[model samples]
Target: MMRPVVYGALAVVLAVGPEMAQTRPKEAASVPAKSLADYSEAMENLAEAASPAVVQILVQRVAPVGQGDSQHMGFVAEQQATGSGVIVDPDGYIVTNAHVVQNARHIDVKILRVDERGQAPHGHLLPAKLVGLDSQVDIAVLKIEGSNLPTLSFLNSDTLRQGRLVMALGSPLGLQNTLTHGVVSATLRQLKPESPMVYIQTDAPINPGNSGGPLLDIEGRIAGINTMIYSESGGNEGIGFAIPANLAKDVYLKLRKDGRVRRGAIGVIPEAITPALAAGLGLDRDSGVILSDVAPHGAADAAGLQPGDVLISIDNKPVREVRDLALTVFQRAPGDELKMVIQRGKEQMTKTVAVLERKNEPNLLEDQASYDAALVRQLGILAVTLDEKVTAILPDLRRLSGVAVAAVPAEYAGLNPGLLAGDVIYEVNTKAIASLDELRAVLNEKKSGDAIVLLVERMGQLIYVTATPE
Candidate 1:
């Protein structure tokens, strides 16, 4: 009996050991290793893991200015807007775009229960309060009434590589619970030269209601927060951008603490290194940022750095453009030491610059943009009030004062020829528009089809534009 038991044990070891050895090769494979045939199934799993955290943001606010009957000017009419958001923390902290809830009187966040066996699932609607908003970065934080809520973790966007698969989960055009898959086309895309935040560009179908949604990577991590699209027709043109999730997380934490973003200001004004400037300065590269001015006694000034130094990197990270430098500086806090690499007349040297808090310094990069909420739409011109913020961005505007053009609707854009966003309207039909009320008073004098001349200021020059409103 003992001999037979020994033989049986030897047989068991031989049979089981061969199978175990086959399973555990020199390289350990992922548990339940994905077969090549399960590629489509993997994407489905990613969406399933993240879908439960995507929330629909519904807002009710006063109707956009000039949206109602012409007879009832300034009448408060109810208007509704729809967008998307994602729960980032288990305690019900939601992340969304600032523009979505800006000035909204009421906000509702709907949490979805993901369905694995079916195609659609109903969600729970809960009231959410705006915790904080940073319109500059276009990020907002909201608090909902729940605990142990479904949440998604954010991945460091710096690790994102171009051509990696990403999925945009949101509500597009009021269609709830939508998912679109695409690959990252570009990273570090900036809208302007001095934009403090960089974007991840993807060829995804992001539309009106898709703002503030989560852009998830294959691992179901939040890579970015869907923000805007570059479209000529006001529709998805395959160019959608997202705020990096890392930036969104940082903004969320700071906004929660102080209700606003506290940025590190080095007090160095940088300009794009254009071809002519590069050639003149003998810079081997023509793309990096150049320190044009260093404010007296500021962080950059205290660091023994001088003007005309080409900034090449920060903290050993390469700074390829002006936005890159600005974004890195914005990420740091006061008293943080930043390691910088600069090209000084063919000599590449590294310097340590201390970051300081920005005190009342105007964010010069904030563009003077208009919104429909401030303009009467029939005139097809959406203008915004120009104040210190606008003047800071365009120093030339400091001397001029008036309402700046934010948008020109397409229908009346041709009629109001030469009118463009950023053009400050100093006067409307001979009446100076020092304030919004003054501009409204001037427009109250106009009749249908009446010809109007606007004294507009654009880029240090003044001109008169004529238009007739129907």
Candidate 2:
């Protein structure tokens, strides 16, 4: 009935009759067969060329004691974690995910070494210092003391298209210098509504330790920074997301220059024009974005922009959706003028709006915190004394003398008193506490199973929280 197929060194030898072979087209028979060995060699070369730029990141931070049990809460412990990063500069600038080094007291980077034979040996470990971080985009810049290091250049991610071949290089699951190949599944993928940031989606096998790695294009250029994945089982299920290279590069430069990213905003609330909204408003087509409200005395209000104005474009770019306008304004620096084309009540007019610096929120104190010596083990928080420098950032402080919570270590998240970053610790057991030493002294006096009461100011509201230190 059926003949068995035989495999050959170059191609599969299907059993075919003389008649079948005679019926084959001459043009098809004249074509040369490509060898898989060539592709394998190409991939090998690419990996060898790019592996040196991929680094393994080691972090040590304080965290909560227990894994999941509620009884083990209110205790702090130290933990070690591993992630990945890519060297972006010859003088030792590295880029990684901000979450990788969150609350990290110590950070080490392992750089792969390529021998003369083009073979990768064990990586050299070096201490790394955090340059700056932007949590919103989950990007951080680090510096290692070195020069003439191997680095990967960032690709123009806007030119990256769907189905373009790409590779993810990182320490996935603690396996250093690992490389996985895939294609760009999607571009400009927005996971949140009305969010200014977008991601490049890929089908690469990204995992836990792959965070902060580089997603490289076929040419071995950095397409994006591997940030996260969409998985239900905690392991890779093929869907992974990365921060676009353009955005990452912008943040890296800003952080390097100012030690922070200052976002600009024009005070206007934009909403996507839905079919239902258009039907109810009875003004324009059910597409593009509309200004729902303009803040009083804000840049938009001062520029004569009002509610019910449909945004046609901003800075010569079409504003088809809310994110378009949001991203454009978010990328602008304060004092930059935005040339806007708006449609208001059947009349199209141009308006120039000035961008204003958006004030930093209280939660951003974690990014500003650099005091590892301020760790309060009993309270599971890094407390900063409210000096002139700290008080300057916290201008609305009701009282200027209380210690501000700089960060809650990842391990000690569920610890006693339930403290958060930006929270000011004012009193302990009705006794006023002013500095880190005073808070530590108060917390150190308590033993295991002793009840502790903390008076904390959060977002301008004072509240009392009670807990027992383990």
TM-score of each model, in listed order: 0.67, 0.84
lDDT per residue for candidate 2 within 1-470, as digits (tens), equals: 13333235224324566666576655455553344566678889999899988899999986667757778765556789999999999999999999999778899999977568876477889999999998888999999988989899999998999999999999999999999999999998999985898999999899999999999998899999999999999999999999999999988998888777777889999998999999999866998899999999999999999999999988888889888988888777788999999999899999999998775365666677654577776777777888765665566778979898888766566563688778888999999998888988888889999878888888889999887988
Q: List the residue pairs that clash in candidate 1.
A: 370-406
Instruction: Give the TM-score comparing model 2 with the true structure, all chains together.
Output: 0.84
Per lDDT, the best of the predicted structures is 2
In model 1, where do residues sit more than 4 Å from their true spots? 1-37, 67-73, 114-121, 282-287, 346-348, 361-470
Which digits, one per residue and each the tens of the lDDT, describe model 1 over residues 1-470?
89999999988767777668687653456644557438779877877778888999999875435544465443445689999999988898899999898757789998886457775657878999888787878998989988888899999998999999899999999888899989999977777754687899999789999999999898889999999999999999999999998899999898788666766799898888888988998888767789999999998999878999988889878887777788888888778899998988879888899998765333312223323356555455666677765554345563456876666544344345577666778887777888766777777778888888888777678888887766
For model 1, how big is the CA root-mean-square deviation? 11.6
Candidate 2, which segments miss by more than 4 Å at Cα? 1-18, 21-39, 114-121, 370-380, 387-393, 396-402, 407-421, 425-435, 442-470
**Quality of model 2 by C-alpha lDDT:** 0.86
